[model samples]
Target: MTNHAAGSIPDAANTLVSENGYYGAYGGSFIPEILVPAFAEISRHFEEIRHDGDFWQRYCALLANYSGRPTPLTYADRLTAHFDRAKIYIKREDLNHTGAHKLNNALGQALLAKRMGKTRIIAETGAGQHGVATATVAAKLGLSATIYMGREDMERQYANVFWMKRLGAEVVGVDYGSQTLKDAINETLRDWVSSFETTHYVLGTASGAHPFPAIVAFFQSIIGVETKDQILQAAGRLPDRVYACVGGGSNALGVFQAFFPHDEVGLVGVEAGGQGRDSSNHAARIAYGEGKPGVAQGYRTMFLQNSDGQMKDTYSIAAGLDYVGVSPILADLSEKGRVRFAAATDAEVVEALQLVMKTEGLIPALESTHAFAGAFQDIAESSKSDIFIINMSGRGDKDIFNIAEGLQDEEWKGFIKRKNSQFEDQSR
Candidate 1:
């Protein structure tokens, strides 16, 4: 690994927000008027504390002492050898505390809530990683935490739900709508409407209305900042192309922000193409479907909607990416050709996950496997000398149960059933 002075890096403040939350024609606060003051408070304090040295000092301290920072940039030697000529590097965000990069923003938001004197934290989660991260930070900071998750998600990601409850968080399951992330978001917003006084909503992703997309991106920028520095030091040059999987675009935007101004570097985001782009089961918002401008879940962005203007159902093997809409910033970037968008089918993602585990001895989250699939395809068509870096957004542990079922591993399922039965009997 190459070593260099970390203090010499350029400040990324200017990259945080170039506009008042609009990343082109998209992104604006379309929330109810009753919630206007809550958004304003978040905007005012975020603007002030973002530049405060003491605030950063505390944030950085937490990152280093608590959640591991400067996560390794691992050169996938074995995996790279599988390709004809391209070099591959994985930004191992899976190694972060709580086994994902979600903690970075979770800690920052929780701290901001503390500064604002909010005693309660509420959030909407899909894969449950964000909820667990939020709950972890809330427990640490002595904040009451409540997480809204879809009933289906709670079952699929029961491991995360269990941890969130163990961490003293109250997990509520929403059975309405698609009974997924979208429904959970609606429930969280409804809760915020009445609890805005004593509670702060820790939105899980970089989507949502004004202030949220920008704020989440600002906090998650740590991933990109370190990636830039680490890659520059290791290779003495930036990678030719950077890849990240876009769920609500938190990890994608996090790693893309630092490279946004670097026109020479290409940024590609992988969306979940569940069955195929042509099938209605996919979540490839920008890649297919009606790419019209609309408003949903408090933000004006491109959504999967019917002709009647109602949001359509979305699906993905990766629960985290199963959403009807994407981040407005991502929508604008994809439209303007600043960032390229690609998609991988669920089958392709599973194959990629298995390939990475076998070749690199590292298991990637199913969500991140989409990026692997896209990057591999891109590398296959590109020049041999090209370098590609993919953001490994999370670990695969949380996905073990779902993956086992997907792979039809009867042995594993039987073992799980036996263990679950024992737990139930003990509880009685």
Candidate 2:
């Protein structure tokens, strides 16, 4: 462990094995025979190329020229003042070219695909940010892109559907169990099994079979590196806490990796409380589930599934946060109490969405609203007066359709009442 002026913990770079993976009993490749060779080839090349100076320089050039890297860190002055002079700053990943933090990892993976001479790219998405990012990069790199999206999500997030089409990606609608992220993933896994020789599966977040979670985390850690330097330069010190939302836990891991060295700096992860945990709807896997190791879409992690290997139905207004299984690294961290996991109800997320828009003039992705809900509440209760940094993971444009759909629903009142009761039950 390295010590800084701020309190310190283990360095992330040192936490990994020589093979580039982690999660003590949680993460590894559990794929079928056909895809195993492809994964092994990709993993071997990735370890070599990651250290190539020329490769990274080209990657940096693309990030600067195309995706606009070194995203700004903005101070939320109005909101900060409201919380008793505690400085609240946001890492503005929402302003990235594709309008979400997903672009950072997509660009990195796409570059790797180009080097591997892969001619086609396949990906799975929930709220569609990853699909849009993949589609954007595939169009730029002149590669064919296929995105598998759940049938339910395809209908709900139609604007993003149009965005993918405009980018020239073929969007395959998955109509399996529940027609959601898990089903979309199942479809993508099937595609990988059939076409691993000619295609690359660009996993969206930092959670998947062996090399993927580690590789994605390495790429996204740029967020934390830049944020650390930027915050120190701006505030003349490190933040007292950092907050981010977890889907498959990529963005959260990205931002958290930087501050992990600073043990005094709290790392908080927020999950979608959805309707509520008690309502059999929320996606707070760490907080409410019996959480056992299981494989879903090829990665072993804590799953909200049954003994017979059937997944439980999960609900969240933010589709990105509705995965039935979380990254094993996160599950391990939570189990060890190295990090704190909290849930934000849909009502709390809505309130947070409204708060940032009204005070900071920023409408964040609905998934990110969960982080704001937790951070704001933590600030309200903490006695320590220090700076806080939160990852503004994505912009809210895709959620306008969700908000509009909610407006037209006749069950809105009843839905809210049931959600409120669920929240009350969990809180009590």
Index of the highest-TM-score prediction:
1
Output the lDDT of residue 409, model 1.
91
Q: What TM-score quantifies how close candidate 2 is to the native fold?
A: 0.90
Q: lDDT winner among the candidates?
A: 1
Candidate 2 per-residue C-alpha lDDT over 1-428 given as tens digits, one digit per residue, 9 for 90 to 100: 11121222223633753343557777777778878799988898777766666766676668777887778889999888667656899999898888998987888888888888899999999999999999999999999999999999888787888999999999999987888888888888888888878788899887788888877877777778778888988899999888999879889988888887688888889988888777788888886655567877777888887779888888898999988888777777777677798889888888788888888899899998889998987886665468888899999999986764544555765786799999999999
Give one clash count per candidate, in the order shown: 0, 1
Candidate 1 similarity to native, TM-score: 0.95
Where does model 2 exceed 4 Å of error? 1-14, 17-20, 405-428
The clash tally of candidate 2 reads 1
Candidate 2 Cα lDDT to native? 0.82
TM-score of each: 0.95, 0.90
Candidate 1 overall lDDT versus native? 0.88
